[model samples]
Target: MSALQEELILSSPYQEFEREEWKDLNGQFNLNLESTDIHSLHALNEPLNMKEIEEIYFPLAHLIELHIKNHDTIRDDSNSFFQRNQQKLPFIVGIAGSVAVGKSTTARVLTKVLSLLPHKPKVELVTTDGFLFSNKVLLEKNIMNRKGFPESYDTKKLLHFLSAIKSGIPQISVPMYSHLEYDILEDEEQKIIEPDILILEGINVLQVTSQKGQNNKVFVSDFFDFSIYVDALEKDIISWYVNRFESLRATAFQNPTSYFHKYADMSLLESREMATQIWNEINKPNLHDNILPTKYRADLILQKGSDHFVESIKVRKI
Candidate 1:
């Protein structure tokens, strides 16, 4: 068989669209987000420009709005059929990707866009960093180097919190995490109070974890109304991570309170070498073994180019 035939047979279940094709769907929507808004929503050291937002995220937000409208209609019909009224639960959107892939920026942009819709629904953004095992716990368990892997998280607690949200609990409080400290804040929590939409952003949000001999556990993605996976080639991601590492050394890592402050004192060459080593030894393995495996489970996948622009989108084929 020809190589082209083999490639065709290996095509994904997702319906792929190039950037031009996807952005054309944004059509007459007044790209109302200003330059300042895009800058504020963007991540530090990530190249997210106004053009990228308008061409990529604006159309995605519009698509999500359509999905929410259809969901509401179906929900109303179900309620009417039962002759009963039930409290509306927030539509949960899970954003998953490799480290340095810009999932946080994507989540922030989506939250702002959804909240600014015609109905102006309440929107809240939460990250799964809070769901991770505290630094103390990791040290005790001797898994400090494996931090972003699934085993380093409090999976049961995360599951419980998500379950409460979907069960229509009036308010839920999640532990807060501090990037400056690179640890969970034992004394602080973020309260999410009855939002109209909840955007859960994290590296492992779409991952499925199960023991080798156990088959009874459900995954975190089961509760998601929608899920997004931010994707890029591994080589591009390594470059991005190294760039971010250097930037953080000059900025946040300089803070005495920063967990990575040790790197702040290192020379430029040393820092770059350490950054590449860490990425190769730790982050790359996690992406290959844990994160990338979950990409097909996403409702939508944003595939980014080496230049940090979203170049394609793959919506799961229903």
Candidate 2:
């Protein structure tokens, strides 16, 4: 056995399941998803199909529904014990992963499935991209190159938003981010209104970040009732990132207003070289330094194959 497998068996707090094993756990029926809906949920270069939903995400959605039920039960028990009628907080689900690892597709698919639960619960999906500093802010901070790094986010704002959600605040407005423009839209906001479950997806979701003078030791994951980390071999992730960049060059980057429009006219070789350089200089270091370290901290980890499909799942033992 590999040392990694041995270590997992010996001391890891997680129980691992191969893809087939995980699929067997999907004892669910009447999933209200169509091929059209599935297609709309996938991000650039990330494929989603009914087979994937049936074999992977259906079980995951059912598991999350179980968690939400438990969360409600606990709240009710706590209220009874305390003799206080406090409002129940939304069950926050955090999804974390490296760039181009299909976190967006996972979040969207899960959101759609959960909304169609037997209870027809309200499910809202939010990405931390909306919390990232705009191009202007990054340039002013002289960290434009560190775009996806922990430091490039408005940590205070994100925390405040999470706090509001847990506080049961209604109609919370989140900053809007445009992938085509590659920046935050100052005038636009996404309203999250009293969802029964909120899925927060981002590379930074599971990270341990603190403000310079933060007295409160609360981390982002503290707001999450359940957390997921999408994981893969670094080599595979780098290839995916490069491939996604190339795809964007052909599609989104061709727009004159795109932040990466300069690369749209580049030859195939030039685009590939640029993507590799960005990955090696920026995304790669961020993954190793900030994202990958938080993998074990997640309640669940989805290990992906080179083909960008989940190969295994590791669930933290309760």
Candidate 3:
């Protein structure tokens, strides 16, 4: 291991174990988890299995649990010292990565696994899509092609949402976006109430920006107790994006009201060309300009092989 990797392991509260060692460690948990394996979390069409989850994700969850416990203890100690009544903030985890890198899947799986922990209370997963500007706003700004760009999102709204969650607010409402419609829904919302853990996933969660003659403030990453970046080769991610686009074309895009319905009847060759064009013109540039630059800010990086399996992990030392 490199010095960085060694430092990460030493600083972390959880023990690092190989894939085969997970079964032995299973008894350590009081809860009966269906499968701690990483592969089980991948989409049904994607190839994944238990061993990947054990070696890669389980350890990360253990570390998160430890961090939550330590945070609670410190909060209690501080409250006693100050003799004040303040609710402890929820442990927030941020997941960031380029599109098609499977960050969403990672966020969902982490939420499930963390919630299954014996001591965990309520785990809520929120995606940055909820904070994106309405399609009308993007259209008005003539930024429809740049929809996924950082400027296309309402950063102020996202910050306020995180602030609300971090303040231990009793209830919060998050807007819902529909990928099929390619816009925020009219009357849909997600309600979160007093979560113990909040998982926030987005393409630019770790992005940093500064205004003229002022220090940077309120980055999405500032609210995170821990952050993860899912990584893969640019070519691999582009290929995955194309594949996913084709899959969506066959299913969701076929819906008459779908934003992409126009592409539903295209030939396979035409679809491939369209997918490649979109990636090269839109998604890839956004990744380079807004997303990939934030990789170093992640507390942990999950590197995936060409086959889409997480082959290695890099945890930054505290």
Candidate 4:
């Protein structure tokens, strides 16, 4: 085993279980159970199956639970010494990955599984998509083509949201964005109050910017208690993106009010070409420049095969 792999195994809570044995244990868990499959929580149209949940997300949720318990104990001990009544901060998990790598599915599954845990009934999942610049702002900047790039998001607002959650604010409201409308709804927001675990899933959640001549300030990563990078081969991801775009063209994009409605009438070949152009010009570049570089920094890495199935997991040793 590589030194990094050895370190990961040693630090992981499930280190005692052999890989095969762990898979068996995970297989025993029926993800289809009424309590386990949360339809309301899923952001995507497709429903995740039990095997996918077991093979990929169950272990991750278990790790998060362990981290939360340990963090609470440490906080209590420190508070006891200081003789104060400060509540422990919520355990924040950052999920990062390239576009169309099934990260949204992974995030949703984690949210569902974590909430199912008896110890943590209140689990909130927030996507950084909400922090993206409004369509008006993007149009004004004339960078709508760079929608998923690092500069497309309002980093300051995202940082403040993380800060508030870290500070243990009683009630935190996060703005909601609609892909169909291609805009963030000003009035609608998701309310998270006293959540035991907070999952912040985004493409650039782990990005770190170094200011010249100053102590490096870790951006969103500083607030993360645990981080995960959902990974797959570049070619596979591109294929998935094109497939997803084709699927959306027939469905969401067909809506009269949808921003991408114009593409709905295009032929399959034309749609594929458009998808390829967008992926090559926008998403691929952003993934290479901003997202892939942060993969090594994750606490756990979930590696997926071409079929969108997680083949292996690598947890970083602390």
Per-residue lDDT of candidate 2, residues 156-257 (tens digit): 899999999988898899999998888999999999988999999999888775645565577889899999999989899888888888988999899998
- Counting clashing residue pairs in each candidate, in order, gives 0, 0, 4, 0
- Candidate 4 off by > 4 Å: 1-21, 24-32, 35-47, 210-218
| Whole-model lDDT values for every prediction | 0.89, 0.89, 0.82, 0.81
lDDT of 3 at 185: 85
lDDT order of candidates, top first: 2, 1, 3, 4
Per-residue alpha-carbon lDDT of candidate 1 for residues 250-272, written as tens digits (9 for 90 to 100):
99999998999999988889889
State which candidate has the highest TM-score: 2
Candidate 3, 6: how far from true, in Å? 14
Where's the lowest-lDDT run of ten residues in candidate 1? 208-217
Model 3, runs deviating above 4 Å = 1-27, 30-41, 210-216
Candidate 4 Cα deviation (angstroms), residue 281: 0.3
lDDT of 4 by residue, 171-289 (tens): 98898999889889888999989888899999999989652343546588999999999899999989888988999999999999998999999999999999999998989889999
Clash list (residue pairs), candidate 4: none
Model 1 spans with C-alpha error above 4 angstroms:
1-11, 211-216
Candidate 1 TM-score to native: 0.94
What C-alpha RMSD separates each model from the true structure?
2.0, 1.7, 4.0, 3.8
